[model samples]
Target chain A: MGPPTLHELFNPVLFYVLLTLGAVGVALASPRKGVSPQIIGGLVVGAAFGGVLVLLGIRGNEAGDLPNLYFYVFALIAILSGLRVITHPKPVYAAIYFILTILSSSAMYLLMQAEFMAFALIIIYAGAILITYLFVIMLATQAPSEEKVASLEGYDSTAREPLTATLAGFALLAVLTGMMAHGMSDLQDSRQVIRPSVHSLEAPILGVLPNKVIREFEQAAVFDHGIAEPTVEEVNDGFDANLRTMAFKIEDRERFDHGLETDTRFRSMLPETIHGDTVLVTLPAERGITNAEGVGFTLIAKHPMALEIAGIILLMAMLGAVVLARKQIELGEDEKAAQLRTLGQGFDDDVAHVGGGM
Target chain B: MITSLAHIAEPVTTVAPDIFGDVGVSLYHYLFVSATLFALGVIGFLTRRNMIVMFLCTEMMFQAAGLALIAFSKYHLNHSGEVFVIFVLTIAAAEAALALALVVLLFRRRETLNAEDWALLRG
Candidate 1:
């Protein structure tokens, strides 16, 4: 009824679903023969990757260790590489650069303890995509003639302006820079206090215990661990008096029974209740500590559908890439020969022209 | 000489003031690194005519972003930023795949993969 709890938001299943969606988005968006699709795919993938982490409860105060930092670094690299791939003129280099980006990103995932994701990235991107790209390049055609190279050089140097792309790239860079700067500044100002507090020292030790057990320990310390049994004021005072008398006897042992009167005041200050004794304590129900681990356990164990969806999406992408990359010859032998003849003629003419000029 | 070396080692061993506390690498350092990387990427993007070099420059930009994200994540001790990084890797992989494929196709048709030769798509 109220806003959904943090447990609901931290659902691993939800994270998987988001990841799957991102994969599908990439598959749909990647260009069949151009850089636009690849760029879009990269953006979608980056968003999905980031979204999963956010949904999986890795962000904010919940993040742990340096692995998370590496994960972020990888994602940022992926996004920038994707942008470069689409915008860059030379396609082959973009491809190689993108691969490097992916590999580094995978390393980041490995750092984050996402072993499965990291391995998958290496296998799919590096092993399959890169090899396939190389094969395609080798099978495609010969290198351009010197004339063609010269023309290309001319075009690059004196081509029509890519005004829109330049403006867009600059704008995006500015926005990203601004956001990064702002986030860094905010974090710097909201400095985390590094005081040598009990919590800081004992957190590693306490983290080993189950959340519920730890909560119980805290509650027991307050109420059941030699505290005055909660009751009406008059009833509690009598219990307190008995606890004080017991403490006085313990203190008297150290002073040969001579300091009993002197330590009576100190003894009275001791808690009234004994261990394992049930007291009529009426603790506020709302004051109970929420078990963080309990919430995480329930979310992961409860939702299996999200995981299945993510798997299916990955499979779809793999299948789609296979289909797209399947070798199919459209031209007949005669047509191929004719094309080769034309290429040969073009080559000869260029050679003859160079000879004549010399 | 040994005593002098020991004196030097004392400062080395306790370089960071415990009183000031140890936060690994300040925000300013992170910002400076990020800025330098970004500037490098921008210059490469602007000056380089080779498409591969341009992509490399873009990768540099990404590296900058990654550095920034990592710096922030470490400071915040948050895993979300890292998780976001994983998604970035996945996308980059896909982009590389398709971009390479296109490059091969372009070369087959035009016999060149140079940026200047890609006037077919312009007008």
Candidate 2:
């Protein structure tokens, strides 16, 4: 893909048309008005959805580009659900819609091959966090009766400042989408961005993996065994296996310094081949390293301090919540008087003295 | 084997740009998705009356940020963006806990979930 073109960034005409239609529909729908305009608004939003993708054109009509379909499908689900979350009269329904938004976004994460984040979104956001919202909604909502659906009754029925809010929200969306479309051409160059290779590793962690264990792999020959193991011949042997290891891109002072910075022991275990300034040491891929491993490696190895700080933040939240939720004990009249008496000392109120004494 | 070590220690050059020209999604697609998600969250946050729902919008915003970070990570082939997502997840979990507790406490006081009803909070 060359640099993005003007049309690829956006369709300005759709922005005005869709915004106008959406704002009008929301205005019509928000006031508990007739259903026709509301339905029309939904349809307009849906059309605008398709229009946004069309204007994007990155995922244009090409059978070859199926991944784009997943993006469109999931994004539509999230967008519609997000709109419903604000528009729905019932708080419980809004919670459910929020779940949809999360699930759809997780699907987007999966498309990007972020398996860890995708599943985390489901288990944490949809599972734990959303369940809490549902419970709160249930606890906070008045029980509906024969006259009304008590579960969803009251202030939730009508949005707060529906017309202005919807207009403002859509305006924000419009500005953002418009900016992404038009403002990003210069920054959106199609440079040949490659996936990070093994050479990117600053740590000799791969170097320290037991040579005996390393020898088991078929592609072990290319591995510069930090010991005096022979470099694999560039013969058809490795070709048959089709398995490759990440080889060092550079072997120099900078790489060694990085190893030392991470850990002296880790740096010390470096094979002579690695420390000797040769870059072709191929680190064998661990058994369970999907793309997520890089993320974990960064947390555990590169940015261990961040992991610890996250734990601290969670601990603090737990403490704060517990403190906030604790019951407030009531004071007896005598106890209250005693408290007031102590306060009187500061003001030096002789007549207001507690226990009727000076 | 020892003789080949010198060759290996230097550069094992990658193929030219055209050599590995595999077509895939661009960085912009992910960015677009993330931006939309965030905007939806912002709209929901502004427009929703339910306190819990508003926080839900905030969580959605966090999700949007995570998506964008992961995509940028993929774009640069770097792991920092992905690792930052771990922190984002942590903060979201923390926010949810504290925010919900506060919501419950507020609801107990006001007996209503409407944002407008809690107007006299400071006095």
Candidate 3:
């Protein structure tokens, strides 16, 4: 028999059962004042998570349809670390776990072939944002005095409303995953199944990148048909006109025309040799559109307004941060007295330093 | 060694579903992960009383949303989803800045990171 489909793999009854188990596990695992049943709860959550993944894997194995092993590994890390991020008692430890979660998420992004976004996630989210979080966590945390055991604050040690939160969260998860598992068949029917073209999504972007195209084709044409490579002198004299003067017949007219309508760059530097089907048509360079270039074009060409808005939003955030940080709030009397004492001590130190200098 | 490395680097050119209605790895797998992450984020945000960690949980939600967007983008064979992730990252950064600044300000006033300290301030 053929393998169990999406519905069978994500059996509603089993899914909900496991989801309930997980929700309970999360509630139990959440940090609490006295002896918390965290380890047992973690085991239950892991078992539940593993049960679903293993079920999916078994069905996937039957169909010979599974993601790369790395996908499973990355997903495991991402989910487990995410759990730890919320469940860990210490705020600093939670932040660290959150970093692990971000790293694994970025790895998953890499697996999904979003190379630009994967690195951007690392750089922006992990590198920049997490550092800010660490800074705030450190700044906000009250330092422990020397005599006492370094204990967690009441808020840090215990979750606020674990049962209600886990129930709400996992119920939403159950609904979402349930929809995805069952509703996929409908989505498949509605979606016009376009034959997956071997040509990449970024293939047309090559036409816009003229200089790279020229550099690539120049060698190929010269090697194959002894077409003269445009000289440095000719390029220096008038690069556009010189490039216009040089053209080659692309063997595949249909494919060239396919990209032609979308790409205006093709219209400007028209291919010189039109009608002949002699040489192979390798006009669009073999090296596909890079992740950065593809994302750059999509950002600049398609969503210029959105990009502008993002910049403005960032600027406003900066201004807002500055305003908030610079605002003076009323200090408690004890803190005000402490501040004054520190200022007085600093003034005395300055006077002592000035006397020493004289 | 080089051949093995090349095998690992083999590119997936397309994601269109095959005869059995499978895109090798079905979109459900990614959606499952994304949903799980997002749910965890919600749980974290709701349960954690540390205001900064609560904000961190919100960041986790943003990360989950970005993952889902990228997955859909891949499923559709489009670049716009990835573009949207860029914007998500931008918003996440802005949020971190403003949220952390607020956290610092609140910490200054109350000298405590507990959310319960400000429970009286409905506004």
Candidate 4:
């Protein structure tokens, strides 16, 4: 009846509940203008989901990697900011949010073990495109006339063309449904890929433990005792039970005896043998690849293409932005000069009229 | 205690008849999230009639697509999903530029930013 395990926190139902709560919290906290509750809710949900994943042993490729959580949080923030770009009324504010979103999404990419994509997302989207958007917004700020403002206010009423919006929404939903169905079908097939083989379980553990101790144990136990070698399952089950007991004892040592037989029981549970006696022990390979060099190798060598494509995409995006933003004035020199003179004359006349009226 | 924790930690493996019963952060979750986002984008696009906001909705769609890709990638344990996401980000940036340029051009032509006022482009 009580909560069973920490992993239950990751249960989809629990995750959904947390998501709903976070969404409600965000909606309540948001200011009364601009972005809808949905966008804010998405941001809050994404951040919380990523945070919970980290806390619940889903961090990176392995469990217990907490720093990666920051990357997900950043991505969520970036996404929120990006959403704000369109939601905000002010162009400057939109640009700011867009920039923040790009930066955060990039951080998310890094967190997902895709370092190259993250940097590319930031450099191209945030550095180039958003700046260009800002420039265009700034340059195009000819104050709207009173009539134009009045029209904009009225536009919202007429804008709700239900037929078109609904049709598009339904179409999107259909496509999403189809895609989701396909994805789930594929996932169902993938369960067969890893069959929880005996070797797969033991190899990782055996790879990590000291070879010298293993050899010494093997010589003493197998050669001397003439006992059949225990299977990987036996070792793992024994180790699991022993570890649980040790953990429980650590929490209440006075209640548990601190003796060699107690330690021997733990040792006998271990799969590895020593001195013809069933020694209870814990294997080491559970902590895979802790060296800095190994970490670097895993990052760079394993996923070079992801990194390269991210870089190329960012570069191309930047170049494209520069080209798009390069202004082309179509006016000839004489026409421009004549127009400026006429504009100047109009300005002077307006200034004189205002001065005389004042 | 460990056994109890294990039971709590593990999701109910047995499937129920409900639509959501089998959905354990699967492709459907990605699609559901995407659809909601796409709907929001559409709503924003239609209701606001502001070119900037419309473009923002388009970005929202792009984000949804990225999310979908990532979810699929996670299911497959492949990097291609992420690669597709990178492409989406690039396309989004390019689209933003073109959209803003068009918005600026429209503003210059009609001397108004309201979409309703810019019917000159209509066939």
Candidate 5:
């Protein structure tokens, strides 16, 4: 009725079949001791991935909801690399493949219009986090000396309970995906349902960031006079159609109005700025809202305490790491007594020498 | 003045479409990706005997969670989801620091990175 839901589009039986195939493939691909059929397993997994994606595509087309072709590309890369991350025998190679997974998923984030987070994922996860992983992997694993260089450690070459683990993991996946498909609705009107609250919180951020507003207005060349600084105030009484009372607080509304009156085209572009009782100054549609600005505002305004807690957690982690990793030199009981006697003798000698010199 | 000010109080119903152009990917699609990634992480964690690789699997799980958060953020047209992801990243970074340090310490003592070496002590 309302744009066909994923429940309607996705066939459960076919999905389970593909999922089971994937589980078998993963088990076969997992690192094993001798004559591991990794190539066949990889092919099987690839086949399963292809089948599931193709099924989704066909169903989506039937429902007249064309899937984003790029989603398929990024999703394939991400999942395959993710599989490699777990299946690869060598730790260094596995870490490298995980980087590939991070990169492709970040690309998906870019596709989702979350540009700030996409780049952050690349910089933080791929750049910082994966580098740490590689360092630890290298640090922990011993490279075999010249003669036996090709042989990998026993633990590195084989997986523990690969079949059982794969079975359990796929079962979990089946349940999660099945529930998501069934329980979730394609709420096309959810935007309208949530937008009012989001807008109320988002608009005040412009008030705090007056420079941003001024920059946009300057770029538009709509205002001749230097716009006055906006005064943002929190409204105490919180119940109305719009919960936040002071949605936008432009102190110099008269000048703003005069400028708007002069430029009809610009004014029309910014229809939300003019209302009966509130002088809300929102960014023009052309300028739009940047991802970083929205994320920053939400972090500071709504979840300041959480942000602070995160900082504290990081600091504690740093301290804990230093304490945990530092090599502590322990002395035997006899060694400690001897060392203390030597230290005392040395201090006495130094004092005597100083007193004689004086 | 009152008429213009009244515009400020008007509820904004249309917020996401104009900015993103169209709702291209369905919520279920991203959820599927997230679920698969998470499940793989679980399998990797359970199967891998190498301690570092096990920790790496946990990091993958964190990445999966972050992906889901971003997707939900886009779906709801809310930045709070993205904000939560930043926190998730912070927690992940913290986890990596502590876990790696413990790994290094363990490796120093036993000269091995196999998780099974510590399993008896853990029990």
Candidate 6:
């Protein structure tokens, strides 16, 4: 779309070609016997090559943005760790590498200003999920007999259909990276005048966001705790146009009732500091609220149903785990006789009755 | 767009100095990172035979998808993406619990962690 300059250094053809080479290297280097030094060497070189390609594609400047080396560093770590996760024969090592990937991606999220989700990822994925995985790996890989020492399974040492799998994976990557290279040009071209994506400062802060959970049968947290307006006006061009048609509560005294056209105008939601005919909403995230609070408020305010469903899901999972892990009951002879007697003529009780009492 | 060597020389650009680089972080950078991570996940999923490792790979893909969602949120300047990530985290936890239980049961039955060994239903 915008001259496709990524092709010059990171052109799809070259990138894919190199990626294919790297993918083949990974597949061929699959753990057989043990991870060969040559395979590790090949993998390191391949990853280093990929990193250099990304570094080459880095563009110099936009406006009001400062790109630092850490983005590149975290990105590389995520990539390399991701690669290590799949290649490592040991499941435990894979899980450890997975932790590195999560941590680095969280760093990437923090860089993008998503502070809440970043830490949440570390807590949930690295803290909870990874621990479960490590436990499972330790449990599942143990030897059944006491005499036989626990050892790696055959599948752990040998990869299944690695060549085809890597090829398929690289093909998908080629298409995606190609899209990122080609499809994102117009956005780059339009970079001369960078517009603020969200007008959080210009928008009115909701009257005071009451920090409390909504009681049952309430209009949700936004009404109970009074979450600020969703900044719909700033993000959506059509919202302001529609607001003009809707009846707004200019004078607070009238009996107010309408659909979204309720008497409460955007101005009513703002603090006393500013006055305006137009309505705008400020994000709690921008208003000095803690990052976690901002995310929780948004969750409670917007996706309360989802939060409830998540809890229900956890409950269901608990039940499912119990059902799956319960020890199987072996029926005793007397119980089997009782069960067989209840089955009537269909099942012979002779087996339970010692040679049919012949 | 004229070709300039200075872009390579200047490590930081003003796209956003505090958050991104000289030409601050764009949607494309995050997209690229996510895509690569996803491909790695997919490759692992396809090639790895250990069930636990395979599950870990799935988590990697989930992370990639979450990264993409957050990047789009930053582009749009919205909170929706982060909200979706919370749900993603929730589902992932449930999935881990169930999957781990299933893996343990299978291993108990076969005394092996290899996925292919449990394929009695192969048609």
Best by TM-score: 5
Candidate 5 off by > 4 Å: A3-7, A143-152, A186-196, A199-275, A278-283, A328-358, B1-25
Q: RMSD for each model, in Å, please?
A: 20.1, 9.7, 12.8, 15.7, 11.0, 11.6
Worst 10 residues of 4 chain A by lDDT: A242-251
- Candidate 6: residue A354 lDDT (0-100): 31
Off by over 4 Å in 1: A1-185, A189-358, B1-25, B42-53, B121-123
Give stretches of model 3 more than 4 Å off.
A1-6, A144-152, A193-203, A207-209, A212-280, A283-285, A328-358, B1-25
Q: Write the per-residue lDDT of candidate 5 for residues A115-213, one digit (tens) a residue.
A: 888998899888998899899888777653554344436667888999889999999999888766655553455565765555443242232334534
In CAPRI terms, where does candidate 1 land?
Answer: incorrect
Alpha-carbon local distance difference test for all models: 0.42, 0.60, 0.70, 0.46, 0.70, 0.62
> Ten-residue segment with the worst summed lDDT in candidate 1 chain A?
A243-252
DockQ for all candidate structures vs. native: 0.06, 0.29, 0.30, 0.15, 0.34, 0.27
lDDT score of residue A126 within candidate 6: 95
Clash pairs (backbone) in predicted model 2:
A144-A150, A278-B9, A279-B9
lDDT of 2 by residue, A1-358 (tens): 5444445444567646765665655555552523435556666666666566655553433312234457878877887786677677777888899899889988987776777778987998899888988987787675434543452366556655666667776787677666655644444343232323424333323323444323222122333432122236644345322223343333344644454345543343344344344443333333224555555555566666787888899999998778667521212144654786787654332233335232
Model 4, TM vs. native: 0.47
TM-scores of the first chain across all predictions? 0.33, 0.66, 0.68, 0.38, 0.72, 0.64
> Model 6: per-residue lDDT, tens digit, A47-148?
644644454445333222333457777887888778778877788888998999999999998888778899989998999889889888887767768643
Task: Quote the positional error of residue A11 for candidate 2 in Å.
Answer: 3.1
Better of 1 and 4 by DockQ: 4
Q: Model 1, range A1-358, lDDT digits (tens) per residue?
A: 1222233324545644654555444343433333345456557756765674444324332322113355456545655565444444454655575576667656754553334445665786567756666555445433456566555433333212333333444444444534543454334345444222211221111122345433433433222122122357766556332221111112223332233224453243333443333322222222211222222222233333443554565566565555445422322244655676787763221112222232
**Weakest lDDT window of 10 consecutive positions for candidate 6 chain B:** B5-14
Residue-level error in angstroms, candidate 5, position B22: 10
